[model samples]
Each structure stands twice: as C-alpha cells, then as structure tokens.
Target: MLISLMGYSMSINLILILKAILILVLGYFAVKIVSSILENGAKKSKIPELVSEFVIKLFSAILYVFVILLAVGVFGVETGPIILGLSASLGLILGFGLQDTLTNLTSGLWIAVMKPLDKDETVQIGGITGKIVEVGIMATKLLTPDNVVITIPNKLVWGSPITNYTRMDLRRVDVAVGVSYGENLDNALSKALELISEHPKVLKDPAPAVVVTGLGESSVDLQLRAWTKTGDYWGVKGDLTKGIYEKYGKEGIEIPFPQMDIHVHKY
Candidate 1:
C-alpha cells in the first residue's frame, strides 16, 4: 500500500512539472505576439518613437512578471502571497536604494509625454548643447557636434530650461563689428547693410540692418542683424563676418586698436 501511494505522488508531481513547462512556452510566444502588436499599433497611431519604445518595454516587463507567476502557480504555489511580497519588496527598494532611479524614470515619462525635446533635434539643456540621440527610461543621450556622446539623467533634463535650436523655421544672425572712431559712420553702416543684403542666403522680407550698439574706448561697435532660414544660420553668420572685415578693409575703414595715454609730472 505504501509503495502504491509513493507511485501516485510521483506521477502527480511529474504532471505538475509538465504543466509548468507548457505554461512557460506559451507565455514566451504570447509575449512575442503582444510586443509585435503593440509596436505596429504605436506606429499606426502616430505615436512618437520615444514614447512608443518606452511603453513597449514597460509593458513587456510587466507581462513577463505575470507570466512567471502563472508558471509558478502550476506547482501549487500561491501567487497572491508571492505578488504581495514582491510588491512590498519593490516598494522598499524603490523607497531607498532606487530613489534617484525612480525620479529619473518619472521625469522621463513626463518628458516623453510633453515632448519638450525630440530625437535628432539640437537642444541646449543643463548647460550642454547637442543633438538628442535617445530619450530612455532613466536618461537622455546626446551626440555633440564634436562627436562626443553624453548621457544626462532625465531629472535634470526635465527640471532645466531647454533650448531647441532646430524647432524654428527661421533664425536671426547677429555679428558684431567695430569701426575706427574717425570712419564715416553713415557710410560704414550703409556698406555693412548692402553687404548683408546682397548675400543669397539672407532673407529679403525682414531686411538686414546694421545698428550702432555702443562706443568702445578706441572704436565704435556695431551689430549686423539679418534673418535667414534656420539651417543657414551658422553659414550666413560666418560669411557676413568675414565679408564685413574684407569690405571694410577695401573701403579704407580703419578698425582701431585700444590705446591709453599716461601723463607724468616731476614732483
């Protein structure tokens, strides 16, 4: 009788193990199918790629946790207690060890929803200027113009002021130039305006202008302001600066050097 009882118990245990394996296999396929569906739906719904990726990953993690618990239940484990214990442990960990990580994650979610910045957009945030590579759950990646990669925590990014340079359709270029105190003020201004106006990239709608900004100790300071398409901002600014110096040289405008005189008397 004892031998028969042991045999029956062994058979039941074997059946339970097989059931657990089957659940795991089905769970794997389910996760795959659900992930694919979510990805396609996000794309079809015109969701931002950043937010889409974050949502998919978050859902996948939760799905995996549930799948594991379901598999464990086949062996007569009580899932309710397990889930409660896991929740308690997660709360404890998040409250202490992962506090900063939790902050970044929440900040990342806010950024994803608000979209203060986007992938490939040039932005200045937290005193760093770069093109956004990716906005992850905990941090943001940036690729600087010099080919350096930077990672910033999302908390700082969300808290700081963001300057997106590429979002605007047009930009204004301001170039400062100085002239000798003795040069023809009106002539210098006219020449500077004409030079900028003739540039192919400068916009005609809001005509370019040169205005006297200040008088330095040795020279008069002027600023050349022009509007151009955003993409041509840097190029236009550089061209205008070089052109001004060359034009002034040919026009005999002397850009004076700073000088100071001292008088001495015998005591």
Candidate 2:
C-alpha cells in the first residue's frame, strides 16, 4: 500500500511539472505576439521610437512576472505569500535605495512623451548646454560643442527649464556695440544697418536695426539686432561683429575706449 501511494504522488508531480513547462512555452509565444502588435501600432501612430521601446519593455516585464508566478504555482507552491513578500521587498527598495532611480525613470518617460528636446537639437537645461544625443530610459545624453558627452539624470532635466535653440526656424542675434561719444550717430546707425542688410545670412523680412540702448560714461551703447536662420545664428553673429569692427576702422567710425583725465594741483 505504501509503495502504491508513493507511485501515485510521483505521477501527480510529473504531470504538474509538464503543465508548468507548457505554461512557460505558451507565455513566451504570447509575449512575442503582443510585442509585435505593439510595434506595429507604434509605427502606425508615429510614436517616438524611444517612448515606444520603453513601453514595450515595461509591458514585457510585467507579462513575464505573471508567467513566472503562474509557473511557480503549478508546482504546489502558494503564490499569495510570495507576492506579498516580493511587494514588501520592492517597496522597501523603492522607498530607500531606488527613489532617485524611480524618479529618473518616470521623468525620462515624460520627457520622451513631451519631447521638450530632441536628438541633435541644441538645448540648455539646468545650466548644462549641449546638443541632445539620446533620450534613454533613465537619462539624457548631450554632446557639447567641445566634444564632451554628458549624461544627465532625467529627474534633473525634467525639473529644470529647457531652452531649445534649434526648434524654431529663426533666431535673433543681439550684438552689443559701443561707439565713442565723439562719433556721428546717424552715420553709425546707417553703416550698421547697411552692413547687416548686405550679409547673406541675415534675413530681410524683419529688417536689421541698430538702436542706441544707453549713454555710457565713455561711449554710446548700441544694440545690433538681426534675425537669421537658426542654423546660421552663430555664424552670422560672428561675421557681423568682425565686419563691424573692420568697417568702422575703414569708415573712420570711432569705437570708444574708456579714458579719464586726472587733474593734479600742488598743495
């Protein structure tokens, strides 16, 4: 009788093991089908690749967890206590060690959705200015003009103000020029406008202007304002500045230097 009972127990265990294997196999196929459907839908909706990839990975992780629980239960192991234990452990880790990591992950997801900055766009965030290289699951990568790659946590990026320089079609270049109080005002203004207008990169629709901003102690401070294509902003500004200095020299316009004449009397 004891031998028969032992044989019966062994048969039941074998059946359970086979069932567990089948469940895992079917789960794998289901995950693949769902993932493929998700990819197709993402393409149809024109979703950002980063956001779509993150969603697919998160969903797949959840599905795998469920599959694992189901397989474990088939072996006569109770799942309720296991789930509770795991939940407690996860809560403790998140509350202590993973708080910042969780914040970065969520922030990255939001950043990917909103797209405040895209790859290859110049941006200033949290005082770090660089072109975006990648928006990852937990961080954003930026490549600075100096050829430095910076990895910033998404939590800080999402929290700070984002200045996207390349998103707009046009950007205004402001050049501060100071002329001597002795120079001709009309001649200065006219020459500045003519120089900017003649530049190939400066846009003509809005028109360029040089305006007297203030009267300084030694000179008249003027602002040279012009609009150019976003990509041409820096180039135009640099060229215009150099052109102004050289033009002023040839045209006899005086760019002032600070000077003070001191009077001394013998006591």
lDDT of 2 by residue, 1-267 (tens): 122331232234667878999999999999989999999999899889778977887899899999999987776567788899899999999999999999998998999888898889999999999999988878899999999999999999999999999999999999988889888899999999899999998988788888999999888998899999999999999998899999888999999887789999999
For model 1, residues 53-135, the per-residue Cα lDDT tens digits are 88898899899889989987775567887899899999999988999999998999999999999998999998899999999
Q: What is the lDDT, from 0 to 100, of the residue 144 in candidate 1?
A: 97
Clashing pairs in 1: none
| Predictions: Cα RMSD each | 5.0, 5.8
Clash tally, candidates in order: 0, 0
Candidate with maximal lDDT:
1
Q: How high is the CA lDDT of each candidate model?
A: 0.90, 0.89
Q: What is the TM-score of each candidate against the true structure?
A: 0.85, 0.78
After best superposition, candidate 2 residue 73: deviation in angstroms? Answer: 7.5
Candidate topping TM-score: 1
TM-score of decoy 2: 0.78
Candidate 1 positional error at 176, Å: 0.9
